[model samples]
Target: MTTTATAGADAVVVGAGHNGLVAANLLADAGWDILVLEATQAPGGAVRSAEVTAPGYLSDLYSSFYPLGYASPVLRGLDLDRYGLTWTHAPDVLAHLLPDGRAAVVNRDVDTTAASLEAFAPGDGDRWRHAYADWREVAEPMLDTITTPFPPVRGGLTLLRRLRVSGALRLARRLVVPVRKLGDELFDGDGGPALLAGCALHTDLSPEEAGSGVYGWLLAMLGQQVGWPVPVGGSQKITDALVARLVARGGRIDYGARVDRVLTARGRAMGVRTVGGATWRARRAVLADIPAPALFLDLVGAAALPPRLVEDLAHFKWDGSTLKVDWALSAPVPWKNRAVAAAGTVHLGADLDGLTTYSAALARGEVPRDPFLLVGQMSVADPSHSPPGTESLWSYTHLPFRRHWRAEEIAGHVERMEEVLEEAAPGFRSLIVGRHVAGPADLEQGDPSLVGGAVGGGTAAAYQQLFLRPIPGLGRADTPVDRLFLASSSAHPGGGVHGAPGANAARAALARDRALTGELYAGVIGAAHRAVYR
Candidate 1:
């Protein structure tokens, strides 16, 4: 109800998550006045850290490792290290522990990782090395292609030049292959295959799902190249560094200012009104860094959206809900296999078939009795996470999306998860000095963007990726409403710590400011939207 006329900025970012912050910083760097509105009390949306389990123990609230963040050119180009962001890594990147004593570890050293794989099956080490080498050939251009705007202009052109005709077709075919198939085709043993499948689980995709192979291969290779680094102090260090960089560039942030509605005039976004009745106007553009459903249905309103968009939204599938447990351990986890202790991340409770069964259970809307867990050994990765000789640990598992979660179910799932961990590491429960549990509702309460505890914005399934992301429309940041952009994980290139969505939104906004070509480009984009949405 209160309009602050003087509180006008060239651009207004609707959320202070990493994507929103990244967008704001890029806009600020261009000498534009930027104002970021965050619903939470802090900037980091899910990329936050706190001592939830006990004092002197730091735990990553949502996301911990940063392979994507490190490999992202948009983030790397910012040089956040100068702003106090220090990355630390463990001896190994990740480990996949099977029910048996065997462990598949991905080490920073490719030869070491190969050797581990070779143990599972003969000549598997050489096969892994070959796959890694093939990855190296297209890694740079592929990374560029995925993180840049849709159509990938420069990155795509460069990739075509690097791998002409047959090579390009081969890579394209591999990208669409199922993770299960990729593993079977590439590795002779369960070791390398299990490692890739576990990495693929990082997304909502099952090992049997199409497009899961790309995620598995990409993440596993990134682990080899970047070692799944984490901030020295906590995940908050990354947020602090980004905030510092944005602030130094004259950008401003307003926390606890939940934007309820995006104000529009003549079909263009002009500002946003917060829940507290304060209106903040945007002189040029408004970029929404929240989830697609929330931005389209709640803030923008269904009446304002096209009927087709609304219909498509009705069919929009969220990834999956989650259940997480954090523990402040009195001592390190007593793993039966000592190799797992050297890695920052550990995947447990599933093999390839088990992973398929888990995914199937989710599709059936039933919680799997045996959930596959993605666990983080914080203290192992960074010694500063807890008191000397102690450990800070956390694990999360995906569940089927539901309207509500009962407390009893949450507790039951937590127990099941711990039992899995206990089996892998005997006496693990005895080491827990304190513990914290976050169910689907608990996670959503902390961050609204994590709707139903779906972390990756939306499902990473083949039917919902690339040009089909969010909906059947242009894969660019521009929206149906002029001057409004989707800068969230729901956009093209999908989710990760990478700042592609935000960077693409910023670039789109900047393109609209050019003198002569700007108007023409807008007309063309506007036409395209009408054709698609109609």
Candidate 2:
């Protein structure tokens, strides 16, 4: 490893993931001299792409879709397009393959999507339209509440004004309902319910779990509003654009620099020491864009944290592990149902019942015999993903957290996934020119933040969500230690590439420095917390 003399920066950010880069960019934009240190040689964390399967095929190693990234309020202001970022979308956002040779397709147009569902059950089309109309009424406020700081006073007020007592109460009830229950209540057909249930599986939540309805509803609505998009060229384009913007603003990133410890003095973070024995001092703040456990236990040390916080960390639950496979396809997936061909994403596991069973198996610490899958047809979404006339396909399935799989077991899982694909898209296996597999252990090896390969930061269960995420308290980005912040997906608004946690952390850091704007923002957030909780 390369070593350099100790240097000082106004703000030191550990990790070069999208969130870390976002924090650095925001601080640097405010004229703070920013320094970012990443343990890996490359940035983007899970949002990365490479020719993993074949030289000509670009495969997203982790995250493929970017509905949240596209809709992020923090990212929208960045004007990433100016830095060479382009988005590509498929004709349809997603499709759920049913057992009866039919598909529940989600189109960007609500009418078209509802029409697709209407085929299965009469009147379901109108029901779908009604649900979307309701979503549209509060979409702006809902997005604002989620993407903004915790408590979301302004967002809450906006929502309250738009939705009076009765409406707000109804919406809140809907959010808390289990996906299975919500689907059963709203739609009579398996098509509509299956689509919603499949969306719930995007997180670790089962269809029967409370609070999962929100996940399903949010993704399904977002698909209609913004259609799942991918960065043109490859996901690396997102990282490249972010890096370009940061560099243009006079920020610097030091790759292959692993932070060993956070240097603190008198209960205030002052700097950080790297594994290379080189120390970089921070004059203002130290922001860690790593998981909470790693930041508190490894870098800052559990001894530095309060005993209660340490104890709370011990009980923090991880979502679940994952098994991802990327394939360089000789041709597009030969779907048994042609309607699924135009979709960028496809969900497999027959119906809601299969999904419920899959989730139950995961809860029992056993791999489901019929695992649910989230498949991405990269070339359909972005032609740049593969060579001419070819395709790049990827699929991922959830696994029990911390479960160890032997080589044979891993192989069996892979075979089972292929069989599931075959069931949905005949001849899908024959089209695979090359393939790459990343088991839970492999994912953790690539990015330590994906602890136990549990993506989405941690469980978004009702008990662990919102204010209780990572730990119980107001979900502010600030930590107990002064001038220190947690800017990872482990923070509020949970996961996805939204960059809210990073932006929130930067705002908190700025507030500590007595910046007037930051102070006012923090004040509003605090007031909102009081109003909501009290």
Candidate 3:
């Protein structure tokens, strides 16, 4: 049953991305009158897919690969494959180009990856294997903890049981361990840190950052287990399928509607106001898939929010840096390191010293002399992202988002980016037919959710994670504003294309209801939040 009156709508969602769509779908299925307002003409903000350059070339607008989505039990429960979502995985998980004309490849076959590590450093194989095993033991449970709206109690206990006795004593220390130190401690040879460091750097994390080492190693294990698979038609298919299901379930999406504020009465959020002067009241709740800063500073307004919230908001650390350059190529990238060509994704940097230099420069708000680049070959992974016989390459290196681009700043950064590619893929630039560059500003234009070009919404650093995310002591999905909640990457389990934040938000809203809708949302959310938090 749908809402007989537009004014009787039970909830309003500010964005129609995967997370927003997931939240909307849950509400609609429960017989709530729901209206999802999307600022973009299209749905799926970062997950949007289109033929950006040429015909038959469907490029994912922003996010590309998603292991998080695959591992997610929340999105999986939706059975999106039936609605038009297919995944294609390469045999090799990834590869990183070393300064010394060699490459390290992480393969889905554990023995193969271990053997590769053994080739570089003999005893490292056993160590790597042990790490993978450890991850498999706690992977799903750990994911459940961060994603659920409530604190993950049982998941934490189960995970603690899996931890090595000694490992338990130093959980906090382990989280704070630098990536370099963690790699060096676990794997004794060159291949160890090189492979793990590259993985750690995947999400704008510096090797020296506390908790990054753990983040890197775990994702690498996940890759070896699942191979960072790209969807057959780009990441957008995930969103489209979810949206299609939502509409089929009697949901409605209103595009080109930009929300400017969340309306509240007596400290309880009840509706949202669009910039165009339209106010839609929510009978139950409102979900904002926007970043916390925008939600608090602009939408909610600092005056309305608590002082601690405003201060906490100011202290939020954003992993600053991203320079995306999408290229239309004549042929596939030819690599000097053969392994680089075979691997779906590549990480580029000269050495530990080189990466350290860039990290320091970035911290100081100055563009790095040499930026570490992450390159993705869209056509190689999924031809749908490019025309036939032609290729589309996605490459970007991090640089401090500061003023004073000085004449050669952008030019030098671009030169270094191309040079990094050329070093691994020797004939890369020569095959380029067209190019488009996106700095932080361009990314902001694409979606306000990607604040300051931080695609993860905010830094995925250890300090800002878990219950402390967005702010400390408020990870229950419910804001101080009562029915208002965050339903985007900015919320916990933090980042990636998975729909946990949206699911968590919807479950919280449905908790206020007790009918069939409440029962369904409760079960799905219960399977998560309770399995973890309670």
Candidate 4:
């Protein structure tokens, strides 16, 4: 049943997710012949959209907002707007609502955001302005360091020069501090703390975690700087643009071609074999836009890997599973706090203690009685998402990971989530004309890379970040096997649709393929792999 192709391209990219498309595009730009193979019929992995709720109601299936995408140097360099990608934003960025009806809102306008924070507690406005000013000083270099390849020598030096050693160390300490502690240190009263805690929960990180402060500070600042914007039509438009750019560069993508085996000979990736028994060789390299576990254990097989690598992978951790519900509504949500209506993204949790309790329950493997929800009103952000006068809405909450979620269990959880929503916006459940729910299994089934509905590739824990990400090795895209690179969120700089992982992979592949330095590149990478893996 297996068929073999006579011709092989310079490189074979194992998935057509945004990361793979990005890697393929960069390689194609380098003038290398590239072929990308995808398991699903669609190009976008989780960055997709559909009308699952009702006709004329468009819902973003997985990720909807894109503050990171808008600011990403990798995405910006591509200039995807030329390929029919248009971005639009809601009037306000995000609002965090409390049960008492007090809300802390973040807007692109600094004055508006400062005034909103000041309403909850006096003098917080000046504190916010001070924080924003501090952020502006290190913003460019900080962002650059994050998006570049690991051991970001160039970016690190620039940042160090800007802040000096003592100042840099102080900033590092602030970032590593717990979100709860950081908020307590930086602001007075509950308003500022609630906003930071809500933003930290964007990842699986609890406010109590060591590295949680970074995510909280980074996202809240980005919300102010860029505003969380969405593609004009849908999230799928982002994917479509990446695809169009790749095709324009003569890169090829084969949908429905599931790569099951990475063919290796003499410890180098030679080609890949698909599930349907087709063999496609890679003349130069093979890049995988799949999870680390899938690439090392499932596709390559354990027998071919080093004992240390196999052991390291065993310690890898995935983030929490999630439950997402989409609703097609007859009218906009009637929020008790009218200001919430103006925002594209809303975070609904009573307060800091409520968030702590919810996160603690998830840590203990129990579904919290009160769920902290991240809600999106697509119609508010883009009118085309729904019919006139109606709304397209969706919200997602994290759950303990499970392979299977019973229908009744899902229904019960959905009911609990809706109850929380109704608390903030009275009569929220009444407007639903149609609804669709996706549990962990549904997300994985739609895109296998989203293992257990762990959207951020893996846990963004301090122990698993930077050089230690995916596994302890050179933090670059190079893998144990020569001519192979990890081009997925599982690599360093994990997750977000920034395409850094793919960009890093493409650069590595291109460097190894260079005529003069090819042998030297292989020698250095091989030594590093042996030192760590052997």
Q: What TM-score does each of the candidates earn? A: 0.99, 0.96, 0.91, 0.99
Q: lDDT of each structure?
A: 0.91, 0.88, 0.77, 0.91
312-387 per-residue lDDT for model 2 (tens digits): 8888888899999999999889988899999999998658888888899999999889888899999999999998
RMSD of 3: 4.8
Model 2 lDDT, residue 389, Cα: 87
- Against the true structure, candidate 4 has what lDDT? 0.91
Higher-scoring candidate on TM-score, 3 or 4: 4
Quality of model 1 by C-alpha lDDT: 0.91
lDDT of 1 by residue, 235-347 (tens): 89888989999999999998999999999888899899998678889988999999999999999998888899989988888999988899999999899999899889999
Instruction: Please write out the lDDT profile of model 3 over residues 153-260, one tens digit for every residue.
Output: 876777678786665666546567888898888887778678788877776677888888877776787788888888887888888898888888878888888988
Please identify model 4 stretches exceeding 4 Å from their true place: 1-3
lDDT of 1 at 357: 94
Candidate 2 lowest-lDDT run of ten: 525-534
